[model samples]
Target: MAYPDNLLSRGESVVLSKRPHWKMLVLPIIFFIVIVGGGFTLAAVLRNWEYHTIAWIVIGVLGLLLLIWLVVVPFLRWRTEHFVITNYHVFFRSGILHRREHQIPLGHIQNMETSVSFWGRLLGFGTLIVESAADQPLEFENVASLPKVQSVLNQLIMDDKQAHRGGPQQGGYPTGPTPAQG
Candidate 1:
């Protein structure tokens, strides 16, 4: 889904937006299949029992609880999580009930690094480490299209730096004459 436009500043525009990689849901989906299949198999086995109706109810409740706690919660969290890069800032927000958000202005970014294993490269997903002017670096894990994301952020940071300086500055001085010189 598109990042909500209202979150951006007046002139800011989104460059990239993504949720965590689909790999993050693999375990949860496996759990769902196992729990659901096991639940159905157990219910079928108990069909001939004298207390079959109560047994079915008990199985259903347990299955539902397992589904909600394991499968449903992770899916909700995945859907709610957002990593957005704009021309001006990088925004990360995630949570279902209680939200956590972090915004780093593009100009504040000092360095960036990406880590990808063989499987991650094959899957087109990896972790991005963003070191801003802040003391500690922030790691964004399971980022989809990690290389593209990193490249876009690099470009945006460069552009932001140039814009703040009123175009690219060379050496240790401004590009043009100073006010006194002018």
Candidate 2:
């Protein structure tokens, strides 16, 4: 699903909207295969036609449960996940059963890093790590189009710096009272 428009602050523009890369699905796919394989294997072991019928029924039910628990739940969680870079903030939201949302304002961001292993680079995806002054670091794992995101973040940080410089400095020596100069 697309990122929710209502989630954006007024006047905030979206720069990038992304889901976790397909590479993240690898483990879930493998889990689905294992569940199906085990189910079939069990059914095959009960060779008699009469026993086979019961085994297939039992296997089907058990397989469904396992698929829901190990494969479907995670896949849905991945689907629900969203990573958004906005002019005002970086947002990450995810959850299958419970909703979670985190945002770090552009002005508060201290650093941004990109990482790609050999396989990740080959696959055209990597992780984006964002460090903010007021919040914990965030690691966006297996994000596609990592280079583009990094470039955008660099631009945003530059813009933020320029914005800060153009504004009046917020704090310094006390304005209300002056120490006796003499």
Candidate 3:
């Protein structure tokens, strides 16, 4: 999806962009299954005729909390987190109540590497490690559409390099003395 042009400065263009891989939803799915299974197990275990009311209430409350986490938490995370890339930088934003954002400039980027697990490969997703000349490496973990993101980043880097190499426009402009005069 295209972000507003006003979001970045002049000469900036989006290079690589993606969301978290669908695989990330797995944990929440497992949590949901566990909650259901546990609820059933609790029901069976508490089938005794003399069960305490307090114990039953506690089990119900725990199950409700689990249900909220499984159903609501994952959905909120999926909706809130976003990974964005521009010609000059990469941006990561996430969180619901307390928002967080991080930006890494392309000029500082030393190299980028991608890793994919068997399941991730099957699903066409991977993790991207962005190394910088400075301390601390930035990681884009479990990112979907990795190959396309990589390709765009590579192309942007090449373009930036070529632009740098072309060197001092308008035919040098003879700063000291002309060769013809010498």
Candidate 4:
């Protein structure tokens, strides 16, 4: 989707919006299974019929809540949280009930780093740390396609710097080799 023209100076364009991969839900899915299994076992083990019924009802409810919290919640969060890279800035947006957005202009970004653990590397995902001149650093965690996102950010930073040096005009920002290309 086109970003508001006013948000960009003249030539800025959005590179991509990185979302948490579906694979990130693995842990939550496991948790849901464990909770549901445990709940069913507890309900089945009760000796008294009345107690068994009550236990089953309570456990069923608890299991449902756990499923909602573990399986559904993270999925919703992954759906909601967006890590957007534009030619001018990086935007982190996340919310379920109350929305929150954090934007860091390329000019204000002092440094950027990406970290991938063994599992993350195997899964092709990682966390991105964006340090800005502002006090709080922005973290884009569990983002899929890490290399592409990092390269886009690097290009944006370089392009912004070059624009400042070259004098601004209305046109798409220059594209260059991503880190992977190097």
Checking candidate 3 for backbone clashes, the offending pairs are none
Ranking by TM-score: 1, 2, 4, 3
The TM-score that candidate 4 achieves is 0.74
Cα lDDT of model 1 by residue, 1-182, tens digit: 66789989999998899999999899899999999999999999999999999999999999999999999999999999999999899999998899999999998899898999899999999999989897589999999999889888888887777778767664255778999999
For model 4 the local lDDT of residue 38 reads: 88
Between candidates 3 and 4, which one is better according to lDDT?
A: 4
- Tell me each candidate's TM-score: 0.90, 0.82, 0.70, 0.74
Residue 39 CA displacement from its true place in model 3, Å:
3.2
Better of 1 and 4 by lDDT: 1
lDDT of 4 at 89: 79
Provide the lDDT at 123 for model 3: 93
Best by lDDT: 1
CA deviation > 4 Å runs, candidate 3: 1-7, 10-16, 37-57, 166-182
lDDT of each: 0.91, 0.85, 0.77, 0.80
Mark the regions of model 4 whose C-alpha exceeds 4 Å error after superposition. 1-13, 38-51, 167-182
Worst 10 residues of 2 by lDDT: 167-176
- TM-score between candidate 3 and the true structure: 0.70
Total clashes, candidate 4?
Answer: 0
**Per-residue accuracy of model 2 over 1-182 as CA lDDT, tens digit each:** 88888888899988999898888789889999999998888888886677788778888998999899889988998899998999888899999779999899998888888889998889889988889897778888889889988888888877777677763243232434446842
